[model samples]
Target chain A: MMTTETVNVQDEKKSAFLGSISSAFQGAETYATLRKSAWDTLSKFAIPGTKTEAWKYTRVGKVINHSWMKSHGNSQINLPEIAIGGLRYVFVDGLFRADLSDELTYPGLNIRRTGENAENNLLGTLSNHQGDWFEALNAAFFNDGLVIEVDKNAQIDRPVHLVFFTSEENTASFSRNVLSLQESSSLHVFTHYIGSEHSTFSSVVTEAFVGKNAALKIDKIQEGNETAFHHVDWTKQDRDSRFDITTVTLKSSWVRNDLNIRVAGENCHSSLTGAYLPSGKEHVDNHTMVDHMVPNCESDEKYKGIVRENATAVFNGKVFVRPDAQKTNAFQQNANIVLDDTATMFSKPELEIYADDVKCSHGSTTGQFDEEAVFYLRARGIGEVMARKLLVEAFLADVITTLSDERLQTYCTEKIQQLMHS
Target chain B: MLHIKDLHANIDGTEILKGLSLDIKPGEIHAIMGPNGSGKSTLASVLAGNEDYEITGGSVTFGDKDLLDLSTEDRAREGLFLAFQYPVEIPGVSNINFLRTAVNEIRQYKGEEPMSAGDFLKLVKERSALVELDGKLANRSVNEGFSGGEKKRNEVFQMAMLEPKLAILDETDSGLDIDALKIVAQGVNAMRSPERSFVVITHYQRLLDYIVPDFVHVLYKGKIVKSGSKELALELEARGYDWIKEEVSA
Candidate 1:
């Protein structure tokens, strides 16, 4: 039998970690409840892995086994550019920087720092083992997170950007955030993961709750240092609502983005798109799960990758339609262009449906540029290098067009161009 | 002028062109008529410096340089062009961009500066008009989603843009309708000049009617078995390739 002392050691360590996260909060009652619940859950479970079906390809064992991961331990981080134009919220080493935060409080918008309650009915009751260790660790140790509530009938035209900045050398950080939108509300929220050149692990788990008849547009852009190991898990959603999520991952030594979305209410629409350009020995993995649990839902997903040099890319997309989810329409396509023979890509588009009436399709392809096309271009007088570059640009241009923000689209296009030449 | 002496070539260890020889003056138009497997297309591909065909024995002289020694793109820059039987479709690259890169590459090979965007666009408009290609298609991806006839016409458009000294039409009329054949041939005819030459490879005598050749040669078993005036194409059209096979084997 395992002694209580053995379990208490683990619980004590978890509480110590939770203590660091609690320093960010102000209120007392909510902080005490969240700290107790986080400690209790951390005592019960360890990190999950391949035995967990949803995390089959995205391994979190290496992430959890690294004992260096802590709560960033009172270290001061001088944050970089957090705001682009309109809004900016900076987090230093996973701790929200209040001085750097802007207070443009407006109607129908409520922003507060809230702690997770020990006995919240839906948020903390169940363990999300669905095979992500980082997500489990985040749920177990997340003491404080942002709570965003968009009131009913509110339409926010300006984009809300969530900037997550962490720069710690040889130290690991774990952070969590949650956003909730009420009925008939609409807004665009952007999340950016920026870090410095450090041997660090930044595990972030975000949950978004979209009420019935709401609309939300989410863009998650990751620009971490090449030496950082970043794993981000997003539990985003649409419920009788419209939700769009786009991620652009440009730099990282090893990065895994796990995105899970559900059309929990009827007549919902969701679009998920991502573009990743990985170079050198870097590895970028994007795993997506879009569940159409209700009827009359539509989802479209397109992910493109440009892998050069010795970079490796993995894309696994799954769409599930429950038995009651009839008339579900889902389309998914993943295309990768590998420039060098040494570069590698593994892509799988999976469909699991129990509904009889649905239109579901998935396709995946990985190959080099067409040789005949190269010869055709060369024969017309184009040099070998210029021809290859043009073909790659043309391949990735469509995905860039999916960015609704004009400025983001232009920036990503220029980055892609520079990446191809690099 | 282009010259070929004792040219012998093989693909996949099987000889396709056996000791064939031909010569073309700068202002002449020549046609080589043969059945499906008589190596008519192989000769054009070889002259354009396609690497798949092995030259067992051959000497091709284009102006003052040896043709076979250069790469495919190098031969292209040397003013040799082959209008493919099936033009390759390059997705994503616009036709204008493709042509501009090709034109600039050739210019660079000649020790000239790159053409400006304005000058290149002007050249594209003028040349596209020669083939009646839509300006919209020129702005779209190269040959992607184009019809069979449109692809062949685009080949002629490229040939006109390059203004090569020697243009080899390798079965350019194979899959074209009469209207498309005439349009492509008209584009070729417009590019003809006293300082340029042509080699038209075809199976039917119909394309010969539009671009009449100064000399006609019958190729059989990889060699030119007979050479004559334009009337020989008419004679072969009347009597089939069976006689040429018999004459060559005999």
Candidate 2:
């Protein structure tokens, strides 16, 4: 529907935006080839418009129209106290703060700064930049991030906490992290994102590799004030490996999460679970895909949302079974509750199976609170508001209970209660 | 303890209870027997402040409070309970958690502190045993996947926990078997006190045999056309409601 003149104008705008940011990393020497390749891809593609099929529900005009400067080194703001006990790594304004972080001296675990380490072959291998704009943006401009590697047969007793705190206004921050687990190693990670008081944009990419017989679980929590947050996760699982990821989004003005998993080996298992609660004109979008490449693999995907006030939520999940992926089991479900009449929810569950012996199913449901259930609680002397809160808590219990960490579960439950009270 | 004067209610623009009147004093168990479509369930629902039924003209006073002006939860907080014919099934909400919330909220309404966890658990054990409810069912979701008998017994169990001043059982014996009916009746009988009153609404005299009522009233159409002692229930059961309908028509 666009004329040639409009296309030319859009191309000019895209070129100007890309040129402004690309100049900042002009003489950087770390990962020079990866950075140059990502920049080339970014220059070729403009920000996806509404006409784009994958981004049809989410509009990125706010991100493209406004000019954003790179965040500076540090801020004068105080660091919030950590609620869950673990080895904490803190990053402020997209730069690692060694003074505020714990010493990198855990047994059988190696932690390196991506900017300082130039020998990580797995750093830019898993993520696909050619098809994703944000992935390319993160790879091209990431200043500093963590590289975590677990030795073979090592089992981590304590969780690893990665905190990304932003305190700058009208700025953009990028972090690219790579996590690799050797054969038979097991690790649990908790990633927390805290935003600034003023409007900002943050793009984070994490690429995880689960070796044979390895187990990796990551619980991500995103809670911020007036921010645009984008997170991209790419994971590859080998034979006899397990991968699990759960993302809980409590607060944000605008957010988008893309999760992609590749089941490359047989006898592999993958799980993707998410719970998002958006209130007060907030917008949240979650897109996920799981590819079954071999036989005898299983994948389970469930995402729930509670949209309040005039907020909007979008969920799209896709499962693909290749021709050789016989005896594959894939299940996907998306459920949403729209609290107010003005709230909106868009849910699409898709399954593409190419093998004849595969078992696949997908379903999506969207509705309001059960009025009969509400009345049943109210008739027991509980107030209407409390009744509704109890129902919401019960609805999200299944997703929250899947978290192995008891403290994290309690923290999430309390956060939900506080948000409901607000 | 409870009074209703010339009560009129309508559901979906159709009148269900017209010019119905009833009165109950402290410690009295009154049985109201009626044929099908005689507004027995409608009266129970209207008294419990159900929003579906519009009170076109009515006056209901419970313990010096304007019952009609209170909301559904407020009615419960003011010591009024309705044992539904078909109990609602709420998945994922445990029965213990629900009862604890109800107990604390009711206590708060009375300006009392919340019950301690130890005492609350003890009370749950004691009250659940009163209805012969399985201990496992007490910890499960509220009435979810319960059988016909278990659901009815759960209704009685909840009533025992709330300890309302005026309890209205709306066809509690509809789907209950003989054993379940007796267990439910026994549970109700155990909770009877000098300050608590009951209004038992039923179709047959079977439930009255277990939980004897002091007075019996026959409802025809929308009003009580005949009022008598326990003998009236037996007479109506022995014969049918044809005499009452013919008497009302004449």
Candidate 3:
């Protein structure tokens, strides 16, 4: 713990720095009190230190103390183009680029930019980003992201993609997004976070409200540069809804994602999965919390991590079944493979239940590759490299193949192989 | 041609083969019959270059290469195949794919281009038919859920696919039924040629009944105790290995 004098100095420096660049950053100041309340939350609970229980395996002080938190002004060039055929909305450095985005015209869907419309009809939700200290910081400083509304009983035929690309190494960018699906609506979403060779800091916060009998499938891919740092997302669910969420992280020198999902309604089904591959001095940590507050809802989670060289990967999955959430079928599994002797992996799969009739189980395993399987493949004339690749893919098939989309599945598989071999 | 001169091997510091010698010609099929603890399987493993067995004082010559210096896979590429007593089961690897990879790798080692997919598929169909293997079984993981007889039949199917010059069968009839034994023997007999030789290692004379060998050798305690014509197998079957043990001791 730091002394009182040092704490005050750090706070003074942080606010002074944030205040100096406040004039250059602007999105929509539609909710004055909401932004003030968000700032208050961050002040009450500052960035955590290493002594904090939740920050035991990670340290964020170095990131918070850096000068990259300063704002940038219209630092724009023609960003790298992508040929993927989807309705994409592009953002560079937390600023929307209309030249790079697609035209938003579809039935039962409503899109509005934070810069185009302050508060953007998502006023109340925007004011309530107090999940954690980092989220509060995101709420206080976030300038632009997206706000999408799906009408009741609407069914989206095509996936909507959101690309967040960054190309700065000495500044920070924060994007806050809001999504709502009324009764019986369904949609699929793809979110990509890409960075140039060196990006200093980045943060993303998403708040969702899923109505009764609604369905939402979200596939998130984080393929930033080795110098890129930081990510955070939060979501909430309503009654009788279905949520299928998948997250894949390939690169990033230091990244921490905080996902808190609350299923407030009965009979809801939620499945959360993630695959994180890191190598060569990278550090990626995922802290997920799924709260089941009502009865008869089920949730399943499986996370796989592969790390080599001196990299470290951490997975902490916490599932909580409330007192009245009976007959809940919740299963959680976390498996990891540390290839090189210098790599490290930390896996903690937790389950807390108060209902006696509920069924909940969690299993965690971390080990090296099975040598017998390798020898068997080699004996069949496959070389060592190709043999190991086949074995690794087979090991991760159960999780990565869960993606129902064929193109996306192949993309993820190739990306994983490239990173692992690199 | 294959020759073993004063072969000696050890497993975990325990000597299993002591001064064993044999000569195999290119056109002859020989049956090696032995009892338990007679170094039968050890010879098969050492010939296949299993790392568990150390060659202490031995020299094995196959064709133009010193067999001891070659790797297990290199030996396979050089037209040497071993039908293991217990074929290893590998999950998540297709049986047909494994065979094709083995065949192509062997061809590549011999400086030949890979076979086309269509031709390879045709070959698989023909080879699979030799043992009456189900078409769907080729798509399944290698020997994962196979019955004991099916596993033995798969070994013969693989042998037909690879078409090796020297095939070593180690205890191929341990637990097979009469029908499976006939099928396995038929597959091997169909592939027999003047240029390809076979060393069939078995503990019973029943397998040799279907595919008679040119000669029969009784392996007792680490050496070949007797060598005679195919009629020797029926004599050893009528009397048991104990009679051969007594004869060798005398």
Report the number of the highest-lDDT candidate: 2
User: Model 2, stretches more than 4 Å misplaced?
Assistant: A1-10, A24-27
Tell me the DockQ of each model, to 2 decimals.
0.58, 0.71, 0.37
| Predicted structure 1, TM vs. truth | 0.85
Residue-wise C-alpha lDDT for candidate 2, range B123-174, written one tens digit per residue: 8889889889999999998899999999988988999999999999989998
Q: TM-score-based ranking, best first? A: 2, 3, 1
Higher-scoring candidate on TM-score, 2 or 3:
2
Candidate with top DockQ is: 2
DockQ rank, highest first?
Answer: 2, 1, 3
The true-versus-predicted C-alpha distance at residue A137 of model 2, in Å, is 1.3
TM-score of chain A of each: 0.83, 0.95, 0.91
Expressed as tens digits, the lDDT of each residue in B97-215 for candidate 3 is 77777888888989999999999999999998998888898887778899999989888888898888899998888899999999999999989999999999998999998878998
Q: Comparing only chain A of model 1 with the true chain A, what is the TM-score?
A: 0.83
* Tens digits of per-residue lDDT for model 3, A285-305: 988888988889999998988
Best by TM-score: 2
Worst 10 residues of 3 chain A by lDDT: A1-10
Candidate 2 lDDT over A6-67, as tens digits, reads: 23234766877777666743455788778877876676666776666678788886666667
- The whole-model C-alpha lDDT of candidate 3 against the native structure comes to 0.79
